[model samples]
Target: MKTEPDAFSLEDLRQRGREPWEGIRNYQARNFLRGMRIGDGVFIYHSRVAAPGIVGTAEVVTTAYPDPTQFDPQSKYYDAASSLARPRWDLVDVAYRHTLAKPFPLERLRALPEFADSPLVRKGNRLSIVPITANQWDRVLQPAR
Candidate 1:
């Protein structure tokens, strides 16, 4: 998933071990989170940085559940229309796996023939969570391999 370095970094995730990935406001991205199953692989990407890229891997530790942030009025992600009984937002727990030896920069991935069609590279695609095929995953890690 793409996260701003200022918000959350790979090192932060490693230190925490696992954390609830909340604050997803997009319906499509929320659906992606809902589709996640335990043990699903995830690429932890850093966005809105000088060198945006995938810096590590993580595993889905929990299935989708109501996002507590949506119920808390003090949270920046809180939704006034959401209720505890029928939350409009959902989140999943992701556990740190490993940091890549070298981050695969977005520019480099865009240049690759295999990743040309990737949702991450698609114009105006801002979904924080995007599903990646096994082949695409392997191609992304080829540099580290």
Candidate 2:
């Protein structure tokens, strides 16, 4: 999933070992979080940085649950309309897996034939979480091949 490196980097996840992937406000992104199952793989993407790209990998450690931040009034991600009885946001804990030997730059990702139809490479597609095919996942993990 995509995050600003300053807010939460791959290094932060590596240090923490695992953390709740939270603060998603968009309905589409929220749905993606809900759809995640334990052991699902995730690409740790750093966006809005000097060089935006996928840098690491992670795996879901927990099923989707209510995001506590959405219930807190002080949190930037808080939703006034959300209630504990029926939370509007959900999160899944992701554990650090591995950091890529070399960062897969966005420019290279866009040029890859495997990602030609991916939402991640599509212009104006800003969903933090996007579904990728198994082929695309393998390509990311073994880009040199």
Q: Work out the TM-score per prediction.
A: 0.95, 0.96
Q: Tens-digit lDDT track for model 1 on 79-124? A: 9999988899999999999999989899888997877777998888
Model 1, C-alpha of 143: deviation from truth (Å): 5.3
Among all windows of ten consecutive residues in candidate 2, which has the lowest summed lDDT? 136-145
How good is model 2 by TM-score?
Answer: 0.96
Q: After superposition, how far is residue 79 of candidate 2 from its true place, in Å?
A: 0.7
Off by over 4 Å in 2: 143-145
Q: Lowest summed-lDDT stretch of 10 residues in model 1?
A: 136-145
Clashes of each: 0, 0
Give the per-residue lDDT digits (tens) of candidate 2, residues 10-64.
Answer: 9999999999988988899889888889999999999999989999899999998
* Local accuracy by lDDT, each model: 0.91, 0.92
